[model samples]
Target: MMNVLSAQDKQRWRQDGYLVLPGFFEQAATEEMLGRARQLLDEFDVEGHPLTTFKTEADGEHVGDDYFIGSNDKIRYFLEPSSLSKPAPGAPSKLLVPPAQSINKIGHALAQLDPVFRKYTLENEKVANVAKDLGYHQSPRVLQSMIICKQPRIGGVVPSHNDSTFLYTDPPSAVGCWIALEECTPQNGCLSFLPGSHKTARVSSRFVKDPSGRGTTFESVAGVEPNEEKWDELDGWVEAACPAGTLVLIHGNVMHRSPPNPSDKSRLIYTFHMIEGAEGYTYDEKNWLQPTKDMPFPALF
Candidate 1:
């Protein structure tokens, strides 16, 4: 059973940019979560759903009004790029298949909106202890959470990138906790990591939205350039296959990627980002997702 991070484990995380906790959550819990996930997916009403699907212009940022702009706090479905149609000029984005099989992820925020996830991430004190042991020191904030549905056959390649790039802080404090609900294996596109990358990896650009919240884009921050090619040349990237109920703690700046799942099995996983909630460190306003004023990302203490 997984417990608090030992000193050796902490050292490994500090030096290697990650630590894997096998069976951190009990098997029964994982099974329950998986069941709930499927139940929610089946229960989601999709009849002429206005925002049931979302997409970015090929190689472009997300574009929309309040209905889309405000998706940050709401539970919603985001479509994978492989499932949407490429429009020419004035045509609406078309769905290539049934909406259920095409979803990339379920959320901008599911932890606060859903009780099953809330129990695992927020109500569990052991997890809070894990976060403290990982060096958050104080109460860590559950900044963002998602149920990544690496849908069978069409799960798009998650490009080589870092968590800090997306959930950047002023001093760059972002930690990712990824849990595999299903068996994550090579055939299903398990996450690949560049070992010891946090020692030198830097936050290059961040996904952001305009102040008016019209369009989402990437803005560069003060950091190092992309060195994926160099890292690959040195054979640094390693595939991390996680079993069900395993928790993988990932540093903010470690370069990682997962290949597209071309297999018949879906690589379903639940993940969330935690950031240092202490003074002086600030989450950039430019970061696209923001919680509602009434229901801000909670403190995990």
Candidate 2:
């Protein structure tokens, strides 16, 4: 494995809670991943798809269902909320565009199901090398891989949140690797991060299955108020504007979000989260996404 993280890179990760490495992957590789994502989107059979719209607002109804919960080990498609027509009273909602163009993301287990995605993710030694450089002292397991399709003009906003809230561990050791498959600009809903927020912010809540086991809800962790920490504040936030093939490493506690895409161009990106999997750390069984015995989380090493 190659030592891609230099002294400066480590410094940036420590100070800013994130690192944007330009040209981390070649153009050809990114284009290939982008092409594969588009092909998967185009080939998706939406005829029977529940057309579940994806949203990340803590106050809004989260995207969850059998289709979503079962996606832990499968590649599933999710629709963009803005691309759907409002349903009339007692009527079902309809998609305003083609299935291929109406998607918000295809996610949760792309690396495990898709050969192409697997090649860039788990099969890539660079990913493991980077995790090692970041000092994942105990054990690191990759999970929750997705291709975020910031579709043309209807891509929805993702409210500021931390990865640990979703993929929680005992000590909250989740790191996200966000790779730009297409050019990410402000017009197309590029990510914005609150610099150093990881060091300051606390993972006080988690998205877990409800007691009924029918749906999910955000519960305060250890009696901490989930709303006490404000993520809406934009002061000192930096826009992560990068070209294709760029890789952005995000700390688990960093406050980050993206605006809606109102531009004609789409901002496509592949992202995955890694969590500490050592014996001491507990991966809550009540968590919305659970690993099956047959397809457990793969070690980063």
Per-residue lDDT over 105-128 for candidate 1, one digit per residue giving the tens place of the 0 to 100 score: 787677888899988989887788
- Per-candidate TM-score against the hidden true structure: 0.89, 0.96
The TM-score of candidate 2 is: 0.96
Taking the tens digit of each residue's C-alpha lDDT, what string does model 2 give over 1-301? 6798999899989999999998999988998999998899889887888888887776558977788888899888888988789988989888898889998888888888889989988888887788788785467888999999989888888889888998888878899999999999999999999988888788888889878767788887896545465667547989999999999999998889999998999999999988888878899888999999999998777
Query: In model 2, which runs have C-alpha deviations exceeding 4 angstroms?
Result: 223-229
Name the weakest run of 10 consecutive residues (lDDT summed) in model 2: 225-234
Candidate 1 clashes between residue pairs 3 or more apart in a chain or in different chains: none
lDDT of 1: 0.78
Displacement of the residue 31 alpha carbon in candidate 1, Å: 0.9
Quantify all predictions' global Cα lDDT against the true fold: 0.78, 0.87
